[model samples]
Target chain A: MAQSADAKAYNAKVYVTLRPSVLDPAGTAVRSGLSHMGYDNVSKVRIGKYIEVELTAESEVAAKSQLDKICDQLLANPVIENYRIEILEAVAV
Target chain B: MAQSADAKAYNAKVYVTLRPSVLDPAGTAVRSGLSHMGYDNVSKVRIGKYIEVELTAESEVAAKSQLDKICDQLLANPVIENYRIEILEAVAV
Candidate 1:
């Protein structure tokens, strides 16, 4: 659920990452390619996605809960990925 | 709108891009930096976002429309960005 018209505005940054146990071949390929291209100082590499979502919500807690539902039930693949979300901006109704 | 449990499984790859007229300083920085670092093959640069979404949808067309709504109304800044979505996989119900 989102929010009613009277709710405040909020911006969320959702980060999705592959689970530690999952093999990220794409990330590995990118890192190896960078190294070959002379970026020797580069260390470990992990690939993730960044999603920015805007919502109108009643409160921070309510907003976070709604976002969690979106992530767990709709966005990220729970079996292979873990996600973290941060509230980037909040504005009064 | 999504599909019922009896629908097929669909995976989507959504690409979000800044409109051609929009300024992308971050992309500029990356491209210039890469050229300076010897990736001279690079020409123009535009920074964008990619999202992978999995869903149960009745058909490809329905899934695409749902994803379009999500992108146009929720995910992208229509004033400055345009988006394209591709159906990557589909499995029987």
Candidate 2:
């Protein structure tokens, strides 16, 4: 990958999951559904959100900083959810 | 980790995303929102699903097979969405 003098476009993959202590009704429902569908071996289920964001940043460090703020402020609810962000290498845009 | 003679409990992570050709109105909306919130460097956004499931199967191969069917039948819509499943190491249950 070639570097530009200015900003580069980076793709970030963010995964947001609920805290272990929080109850997930939706996951419980899905687990029940699977059990009824004859997948009785299923024991637990948890649902979360996956987001991909493409942004321009001056450097990889800048991209990560921006993504961290974005995840905390927008991509996840800090009260009950935790988020993990992975920023892919710069891509031509 | 030691496995039981009959079945071992496997942890699986499933990621479901829309096909590249599909229109993602929600992601678009989020991008716009980010732009409005002073994150003008943001270029694109795509939203998807992340799921974790625990189930018992005779082997890792069987766990993957069962997950494939579950994703096809219930977790993802084949026409518009694509899914990737990863089975983590077995855990005692």
Candidate 3:
């Protein structure tokens, strides 16, 4: 039997946080919920989303452009939040 | 009235994790660094990355396709980690 080929590999990390001046209703709600859930020791509660993606792209440039679009157009709120991206590695699939 | 109009708004969240079997040297180093930094109370420290992007798109479908390409191609490691995407909102730019 012959071996099949693999897809390209890449890694991206994204972080989201509420803007300094904007009130974070969601965070406040989570904290309150935690307190009600019996987690009395929980001093602070900030809720954020985390996503991981796997893809095959022709080059790093194309990959980055696509990643940036996702962050700006779908995954983050610019009005009240700030974010950053990190590239972990580029490896063969 | 002077209004130049706004650009479309989108948000994304990306999470990266080491494959269960692969040793996380980077994470280990950070944990060790924290211990040396006099934060001995910190335990089981895990490190990850986050990104925020802004863009303009014609429609939601196009936006989704672009976002998926970003995840599968750039933002995630398929071998060791799994990822998910969230769309916060679609507003006029």
Candidate 4:
């Protein structure tokens, strides 16, 4: 079945990062690797996940809400990470 | 030893995403999962890596150049993924 004409497709960019107080072993490993590669000036390496979600909604507001809900509920762990969501341009399906 | 006064610490936000033409099994799996969870409107889910590197450099231009090099050489696979680099505000150590 085809999507409705009123349904707008959006690309959501979600950024999930570790909170300032948490310890990041993966970030430490990456920092060490950079140091070994001669990027000695590099420090405070924090790594995170980037998720791009495409979905169809009635409007941008609805899309934003859904993205926010997903980020808070599934994409990020609120206790240890913070999530930022951006709604990109709407595209045709 | 302390960093020089001229060395400004900047946060680099690197986003690495797979090329649109490439097959994204991880993304497909996530889409399926979302669908199974009742998000039938969700589709085209792409997964990527977000890296935050805090480094001390003389200027924003220099920091951007270094980030470009790192993304091209080590952080991202040029063959399948494209990367974007952003230099954020300088932070005090």
Candidate 5:
């Protein structure tokens, strides 16, 4: 791709996980399913959402800050879930 | 927790992502939402599933093998989605 004068691209991998203290009904159902399938050793399972975001910004710092804001505002529920953001490779767009 | 004579605990973190060629409507929706929020620089976005599984096994290798099978059979749609598995810290149960 041709480089744009001001286009800086960054990829963010965001992980949203439920708090450990909360009950996970879906996870429990999956666990029960595993047990029924003879995987009785399986004990606990937790399900969460994973998001990959690609954006352009002026700098890596700017992309990271924006990703944090996005995660906080829309990607995750702060009251019951915790989100972690990892900045992947950045490239010029 | 008291140790069980034969219980070996392993945690698995799995990431499931759609193949690059596939269309991701959910991701596109999120991208549109971000653009509405003034993040015009945002380009590509992908949405995936994250799962955490805790199990008891004889060894890490055993747990990993089982996890691979689980991901293949239930956790991911192998035809369109790719999955990566990471074996987290193992502990005696």
Candidate 6:
């Protein structure tokens, strides 16, 4: 596969979740709701954000670095939330 | 490895995104934000929900079936949102 080092499209899947030490009241409410719905199997529930970003970069490394900055600046709150990123080459459809 | 068939713990990572046919105004807003922040490399952005549900079930099959119902009834709306589920055994930390 011929690759372009100058400009390549990439897609990023980012998951932002609360740090383990932080309390998630909404999650607790969901757990209680599940219990009320007779879903006794539910033990815990944590809600977070899933973001898909499409961008063009020179390489995977470049894309990753940019995404890290993007997440830190806008996608996630670094103090109480942690973000994970996965990048994939953009395939032409 | 001895495993309990009656009751076992599992964690479900559910990603809820808008259907392809639907428009993501929030994502567009974020993309604009990135552009304004001088990240012009970004082409598109789509924001979605990431739900972490911790539950106990008899088996993977049981866990999946129950989760399908839960997502359909509570976690995700079938009309505009599409949800994907990834289940992993809850490891003791």
Off by over 4 Å in 1: A1-5, B1-93
Cα misplacement distance, residue B76 of candidate 2 (Å): 0.7
Clashing pairs in 6: none
Report the error of model 4 at residue A38, Å. 1.0
> Candidate 3 lDDT, tens digit per residue, B1-93?
112244345554444555657676665664465456543322333344433333344444554665565556555567766555555544555
Candidate 4 lDDT over residue span A29-84, tens digit each = 98898888888889878889999998898878988988777777667899999999
Error of 4 at B69 (Å): 1.8
Could you tell which candidate, 3 or 4, scores higher by DockQ? 4
DockQ of each: 0.04, 0.56, 0.03, 0.61, 0.58, 0.54
Indicate whether candidate 1 or candidate 4 has the larger DockQ: 4
Which residue segments of model 6 deviate by more than 4 Å?
A1-5, B1-5, B91-93
Candidate 6: docking tier: medium
Model 6 chain A, poorest ten-residue lDDT window?
A1-10
How many clashes in each candidate?
0, 0, 27, 0, 0, 0
Q: Is candidate 3 or candidate 4 better by TM-score?
A: 4
Q: Interface RMSD for every prediction, one decimal?
A: 19.6, 5.0, 17.1, 2.8, 4.5, 5.7
> Best candidate, DockQ-wise?
4
- lDDT string, candidate 6, B13-90, tens digits: 999999988999999999999999989888889889999998887788988999999999998989999999999988
Docking class of 3: incorrect
At residue B14, candidate 6 shows an lDDT of: 93
- Arranged by DockQ with the best first, the candidates are 4, 5, 2, 6, 1, 3
lDDT of 4 by residue, B1-93 (tens): 235777888988999999999988988987887777777898778999999999988888988998888888788999999999999867765
What is the C-alpha lDDT profile of model 3 across A14-83, one tens digit per residue? 5666666877566566446545654332233344544344434445565566556656765577777676
Per-candidate fnat, comma-separated: 0.06, 0.76, 0.04, 0.77, 0.80, 0.82
